[model samples]
Target: MDLSFLSEQVLWGISVGQLIVAAVLPLLGFLAQSVVRRLLRRVMSRLRKEGDLSVVDDVNRLLTRPLSFLINVALWNGVIGLLDLPEEPLSIHSWATTLGMVALILVIAYCAFHVVDVFAGIATRAAEKTETKLDDQLVAPVTNTVKLLVALIMVAAILGQFGYSATGLIASLSIGGLAVAFAAKDTLANIFGSIVIFSERPFQIGDIVEISGVEGAVEEVGIRSTRIRQFDQTVSILPNQTFTNVEVRNLSKRESRRVRFEVTLTHEATVAQLEDFLDSIRHSLAQRTDLHPDQSMVRLTKLDTNGLGVLVQAFTISTDFAEFMVTQEEILLRVRRLAEEQELPIMPAKEVRLSGEVGEPRSS
Candidate 1:
């Protein structure tokens, strides 16, 4: 533990310079780091005043720690270079510089990733204001691709620092990628299907769509699959490729919902009663604000053995399911009141025969 022994021991064959410089370099590095941080704070303050707050905040948050480390490394590298060390095959200075360069590359890649994420958030916010969801869906994929590219570049730079060539690595990756594509052809097709979805935009998030006999509201459109929440509250995860293969009906895009059905009445009713019933229905429908004025019809469409089939076809102005149900209920109630007021017989006829006697037909 003697102080004189520390002075006698040489580090990398440097006896006098190692101990003195090690003690002084930390202090100098700290002072230089403090100055740089103060300058950065001032620059960030000015940026906040002139530029976007989010951009400035992101830059300050992502770069602050890496910049501090870089400044400290630079100061130490300069101090270490000043030492009078013996020539060796692998010196401490050379190792420190190499490590420093690699560390710098990693920090740069980290900052680039965060920057991409911030920009993606901004892009998503902008996309939300527009009606189409194509831009919104593209945000994640674009951000991830940018980050991957940045990471690949950083890897190449680091490899180059160690005197390794990235050409062979890239070629090997290309060949490996081809092999993977062949093995996972369906996965690639789904990915391409997602691209087609974003570009074509047949259906978007929250759209009520019917595809392959399944009807639901689109919850999320992901890269490989789309999530749909059914009317029964169950969720269905469909592959993106399914959308490309099948026809998708976007119910939400329909301007109005059609209501069509036949109301059967007893054949005992006279033609005058049938005419009055039809007239009453037309009058009621015309008075309704929910029904489309130009697309309503109430007419006797068929004469069956049991009764007359009165076709009531109309379109409601509302596309909402709940609203459509309410409008249909209102129309039915109005028809019921009209039939009751007019005293029109609405039951179907039945036939009966006597069993014991000579098969006489009778109405039961």
Candidate 2:
């Protein structure tokens, strides 16, 4: 087989043409991007001059991502077209090409939408009067959910472009949903629970709370679980559903804690002395304006064989554990000093017995 059919002049011309096109395409690509960038700047400057910074900022950010993507895409297409593709015996399907183009367009639209969403999130947070990390918490889920929906729609559209049926896929998913539901029951419960928790706000991150005998400060409230940093320096992970179903005690909710305790006094105390002691305690407590005025209550409740049980109630202004402990100690110390000055002794239990109860007399 003598292959002298291909002439050198034709091959040389094709190579020269490819080289020239490659060198010129880059210059053209740069000019196009430069023109687009100038147009965007002019538009943004006009918006800013009109005192609509919000719109200007949005447009500025929106143009940047897509413009960069567009410029890169142009460069790529220019390079690809410049190459002298081989003339070989091959077949190409028009339908497949059309489907590919549609998918490409869909992907580009999705990316543009994603850029807009990011800018919107930033603008929303900046415009708010008050700041909260909850905004940060919500943005991820909202953005992801939107992206997922958009992607699903784009996929369906692309599939339809290829003559695939959306209804058939939906039916297949429905058929498989039962088993999937069974496998993901906990996840579903947690998702639903997160909704409830966010709406109700039983507890938030950084709040000291107690639930199911576990006491700790909430570290994070996630979509599926809540993490708490325990007092013992370990972390506890509880399912979000548990908080929805079980009782949660939020210590941060209460500004103060009411403390209850009982102290026994000697049964031998005279009524006058007891009255004096009670009056002293009341007076001492009344002097403490830091404590809730309505919270001070002391009473003689019961008389026991050992002593008189005196019930005492007081309030601490702060729910902080350390503060509560300090206030409690001070109150007890004051009570002790006052009792000592009044000579009221702490009651002590006693036992007495009689000699010669029943005995036969012996002859001496």
Best by lDDT: 1
lDDT of 1 by residue, 1-364 (tens): 5566545656666656467777788898788778878988888898888967876777776677767766766665565566644447656566767777887788668767777877887898899999987678779877887888998899899999888889977777997878887988988788888998898899888899998888999988878888899999999998889987889899999999988877788888899999989998898888889888978999899897868889888999989999999888887777878888998877644668555566665556
Task: Assess candidate 2 and give its TM-score to the true structure.
Answer: 0.72
For all candidates in order, the CA lDDT equals: 0.82, 0.75
lDDT for 179 (candidate 2):
81
lDDT digits (tens) for residues 13-105 of candidate 2: 446556666678778878878888899989998998999786776787677657766665656555554553444433123443554457465
CA error at residue 309 for candidate 1, angstroms? 1.5
lDDT of 2 at 343: 94
Cα-lDDT of candidate 1: 0.82
Supply the global lDDT for candidate 2: 0.75
Q: Tell me how far candidate 2 lies from the true structure as C-alpha RMSD in angstroms.
A: 8.0
* Inter-residue clash pairs, candidate 1: none
